[model samples]
Target: MEWNERIAFVRKAAGLTQEQLGQLLGVTRQAVSKWESAQTVPDAVTIARLCEALHVSADFVLLGKEPEPPDNAGDAPPYALPDTCPCCGRPVSGTICPVCGYTLPTTPPRGPRYAIVASRVSFVNEEDRAAELVKYCGMPESYAKAAVHQMQEYASFFLLRRNLTDSAAQWIAAHLDGSCFSLRIVQDNGEESNDALLTKPKAMELPAPAAPKQGGLGFWGVVGAVIVALLILSFF
Candidate 1:
């Protein structure tokens, strides 16, 4: 059966009418009808919500593929469906959370890290700028002072710092004046390496071509001189 038919089958198995499923998914009944009739396909986010509402996996909904049974099924404990989504605190009864579409992580959660990058910056008093950084960006006074000093010296594209928390990066991007400083936040991949924004490097000056060696006689001149000396010796 097609994906649309699969959606219909799952909805019926879950004892949900089209209107009820629409209400659960925050969509109109007509939208659900279109999905069942194969007139329109739901977007990724809506499909995720549909999976949650129907208590089915995406593979089953989209590809009609049933989940494989675990190899040690007899030894495993029965999995219980959650009553509410932990992320958004919304009512749900599936492995996938409907409100935030959160699923149980198979791996350990990595803390997100962010970086603040500056493309341009205006001249400001160091003390005032340091104070602003401290107050607005949640930067330490000493670090803020050092950052301001670096900005003054560079006056071009440069990274403020990496390994910052998301809130701090957002605060720096939001609170800094746009005209004075073009700031952006970049999320790091939980690595210790510093990633800088792309920027054009200064054009390097090439040394001027070396002037031709001064006062060097031509090969023809040397040959002519040798012939002249031979002639003069013969005459002598």
Candidate 2:
């Protein structure tokens, strides 16, 4: 499906009218209609905003695609970690996933965000979930928190890829309890997803080609060398 189609589907799936979706995206209802109609592509940030609003992975919304979920989603749980996961049913403490060879993290994180039981119950399109997490979960909003967002996004990417290992890749979805970092969240209930939104997700984008090397190749080097020679002659 194209992004436009996905966007339209997501809006409707979230039970948002174009006017509602438009309000969330800070655009007019007619503009939202145009986008759904494919009159123009939404800018990158707009796509990101829409994904958060829908609670679907951004890839699903923008690319009309998702990284495949992981390889062991359907496998029987390994016995070593207990039939049920003490830590979110992600088979661990084994040399390899008997089911699918995915390596567990070197060490799992702990506290509020660590366990599935602690998962936050979020309202659909509820961006306030961010503040709730920061306040309630003891999740620090340092630059490091951005690392966690990357972790979540990677897991989502893995899911879109439809790999069986995708579920294992993420920290258990945050208990839709409340928010910490100003995230946008959605719960279709029809869909099994979590969290809501991130206030500022941290990931690197290519830096605009360093401003195109600025005017005239070798401009600085040649000028510097001539200035150096001029200084030497004056000293002599």
Candidate 3:
């Protein structure tokens, strides 16, 4: 492909809008649009920036082939963790792309509630869970009522991180043993919402090597146990 075509291809493949690319490149959306349309081309400096942002070699952008790495520390391990979404080329280790909601093709299919057996909990609606928290944790009635929304906001950050970084996936795996939290939206008709992240999983970023176990639960597992312990205590 021509350089113009190549630029467009890499940008879209990188899961960046023209505006986003322009923002990264210190140009206007119009300029990026013009470049993709072949009305103009990026200068040498811009080309360098594009390569760095995309984590691709200049040769690949210019000639569509990545040159071989040197036989030294320069060469990355063949099985190094993914820093970008394979589908959209956006960096993410989450089950789905945050930018385009592209699920990893390799992620396994899931049912209504998919979680690691150890990490798995009952799929209660947020309202019910909030009520339980209030009653069980002895939290302020108002605070308990509003907890779900607050947690959801925090969850959004987790979701976004899941979408943009593979690190989320690794942490989930190492801690939960492949058990990841999924929220389901139940419709009045008794059907689950059609969101893929809720029902079907997408490509997940694999975690790096885990630390040595201290003969106990992982970090999240311990946290979960503490929550359960608190709930149990509240009953008394």
Candidate 4:
């Protein structure tokens, strides 16, 4: 596809309108329209901004191809030894720092640990759920949002099953940061529900959750089913 088509495709895929993309780029909607119409091409800086905003690579936008991976894609950073401690800012070499006595961590920090739990409750969007997590669980806002999204995509199948509440709880617990932070999924039983697709993990480190062929029961579908079941139980 051409650059214009790629821009339009990515923008729509990201759930953004021309005006929204314009606002994000600090340009007018007409400007975005022109770009999408192939009347004008984004400059180098604007192209970079576009890539960042759309969460895509420049190569994909320009050539419709994923960028080639580096030869040492999975290798560690080129430099060795402690240039400075990430915690204390003291410089040292050859293992533990003498001044701070802090040893380098075995694995890189993957943000704060969190666990989510879902009962037979109404579905909540990730944004609101993220806010609740930060408000009640004392989680970092960015981390909470990302983690909520990850949980949703991987566990939507489990989320829809009323009898599998225990399984959902177990899944969350297993993924929680066992060392320091205790991220808990607080149940939100509000009336409103959404049917939006959850954001996917950018790169898969492990296998994805086994969901139904139809992309798991949508949030709204689950909500409707739960409400009907409740009504039936009440009538009985």
Best by TM-score: 3
- CA shift of 203, model 2, Å: 35
Residue-wise C-alpha lDDT for candidate 3, range 1-236, written one tens digit per residue:
86567787877766577886776667899998888777976665566666655555555665566578557744544443355553335565433343433334433323332221111233246566555334322345577546545554554311112132233333333432222333221211222432323333344334543453322344344434434433543476
Q: Candidate 4 — which residues are off by over 4 angstroms? A: 67-236
Write down the TM-score for model 2: 0.31
- What's every prediction's RMSD, in angstroms? 28.5, 20.6, 19.4, 23.9
Worst-scoring 10-residue span by lDDT in model 1: 202-211
lDDT of each: 0.59, 0.41, 0.47, 0.49
lDDT of 4 by residue, 62-152 (tens): 6677667889776976545445543334454433333322344435433322223332123356677666445433456797676567656
lDDT of 1 by residue, 18-121 (tens): 88778778899999999999898776657766665555776677656789987877785655544643333445554444333334332333467666666546
- Regions of candidate 1 where Cα sits further than 4 Å from its true position: 1-113, 156-158, 161-168, 195-236
Candidate 1: give the clashing pairs. none
The better-scoring model by lDDT among 2 and 4 is: 4
What's the TM-score of each model vs. the native?
A: 0.32, 0.31, 0.33, 0.32
TM-score of 4: 0.32
Candidate 3 segments whose C-alpha is farther than 4 A from its true place: 66-166, 169-236
